[model samples]
Target: MLSIKNLTKIYGGKNKAVDDISLDIEQGEFIAFIGTSGSGKTTALRMINRMIEPTSGSIEIDGKDVMQMNPVELRRSIGYVIQQIGLLPHLTIKENIVLVPKLLKWSEERKDKKARELINLVDLPESYLDRYPNELSGGQQQRIGVIRALAAEQDIILMDEPFGALDPITRDTLQDLVKVLQKKLGKTFIFVTHDMDEAIKLADRIAILSNGQLIQFDTPDEILRNPANQFVRDFIGENRLIQDRPNMRTVEDAMIKPISVTADKSLSEVISIMRERRVDTIFVTRNDGTLLGYLDIEDINEGYRKGKDLVDIMHRDLFKIQIHDKLQDSVRTILKRNLRNIPVVDENNILLGLITRSNLVDIVYDSIWGETPAGVDEA
Candidate 1:
């Protein structure tokens, strides 16, 4: 277990980057530090690894003070992964992964054996072992960055926005990879990210920070259902406030007006509408505006170039939530479908708006408990 008490970090003059934050994270827990810029989430994360010193506080791992150990020795035992994916461009994948074990004078056979084992664990081909970092894609490199952190067999790992730069598909893929590794290995993870959806999806509990103070630390479900203040609610975005309506508002209240096109539309027309709207998915409809399905660009990109019609390549699975249905009622269907956005329909089964994963994230976080977050702005 990791215990932090009265953790504080003050910079030049009187600026406190992290102020009196205290938390107790159980072993094998996956916790996230999330907030807007300069909320001290990153500061708090950095301090745990001693990359940034704390002005006043105590951090203990397994009942031992982290400060009492040698800095070099302490770091070697704690895995760290960052957004930049700081792999040495010149080093082979195997060599990069075993940096710490090499420092500890591990035998050549042992290092190679462990390296190959982890490579397989992440489902990477054995051929990747001899490849240089430059030879891999951004997603592949980030995967290497993550596995390298675990290469040393550290029970605790700290990741700071590790997937922040990847494309949405790659980011989602990596998040699933990390969650699988976290559960299979039973490792303790303190992840830092500004994306609330990422936090809600991965963390067992979230540690919300603002102005360097630990505002609220609880399960993802609780934080969304009951924010401590306006800042928390605002950071969660405007949709978080919808839970407090007297009738417990439905997806209709939070859904966005959708931009859609007919299935018969040419691929060019579909692409044009999507480009103009800057949207990832476009709903397909019939002449009467009846819902058809939706198109995922990736699933049909090649087909689109072959002059295939939108109807030919578009997804046929019709997943939607009714406008009158309470928000919580759709949580299971939304997440179970792993959809980016779902079509919202009215009583007549006419498309209304799009209920996106980004919007549904907050609602799902609290829906299980049927509690609304605090601080609903009555404007």
Candidate 2:
């Protein structure tokens, strides 16, 4: 458990960057600190590892005072990720990830094994471990930075706007990845961000700060449903208050049956089904209704002569959404990625349905224009 009691930071003489803030974080909880610029979110976070000393109060990790511990040892015991990534350009990806382990004097064999495991955790190829950090893209390098923080298996991870620099798609992907890693590894995370959507999406609880004071700290749903005051409501923005909008709340509300076929189907049969449905793409499912992949008209045009069945030419690099995801969370992805439609699956990856661009338009239209008037009829 991590406890902060009356944590306060005053710069120079009288500037209170973090004023009388207090919160308790449970083991393995994902917490986010968010506020406007100069609101002291970053200051409060930096205070956790003694990057910035507090002017008053205390921070205890598992009942031990962090301030009393050696600063170097305290920092090395905590995982930290930042916006700049801070990967050394001269080191290989493997070497970078295992730096902490090496400092801790872990054996070479154990370090190598740990490096490979972390690389796989981020869904990167093991071959990239030998490559230099400069060889990876921005997003890939960020992934390395994330795993490097975890390389030493620290109990608590502090991330300061780690995904803020990436494009929307990459940021979204990394958010999902980090959340999954946090849950799977059972690591405590204290993330600082300015994005409410990101905070709600990733945090078990959010700490909204303002003017060097803690405004509200609670679960995302609780904060959205019952904002503490006008400041919080304004901070959250009106558009995200989807509770009042009843027409389309979740992806499941708008999903329509996808045009799909079993993976055993022949090329001619799959093509005929697409022609009948007037869709350029057709999903391929297994006998158990698991999403195998999809085949598009272009794939057929290029590989029909050599392919044996739908699985032969199907593309598995598919983007998808869960059935229970909020519509608001998915809207930006659909529009920004310019996708015609995205598959909706259940927890088990079973093909539930699909949400198309048309469905999204109708949802947005209804949210703005509302349902048809009583006794009204269309021409």
lDDT tens per residue, model 1, 137-180: 99998998998999889999999999999987788779978998
Please give, for residues 262-371, the per-residue lDDT of candidate 2 as tens digits: 98888898888899999998899998999988888999977787755667778998899998987776876777789886999999999999998998877775765566
Q: TM-scores of all models? A: 0.68, 0.90
Using alpha carbons, what is the TM-score of model 1? 0.68
Indicate which candidate wins on lDDT.
Answer: 2
Error of 2 at 191 (Å): 0.9
**True-structure lDDT of candidate 1:** 0.84
Worst 10 residues of 1 by lDDT: 239-248
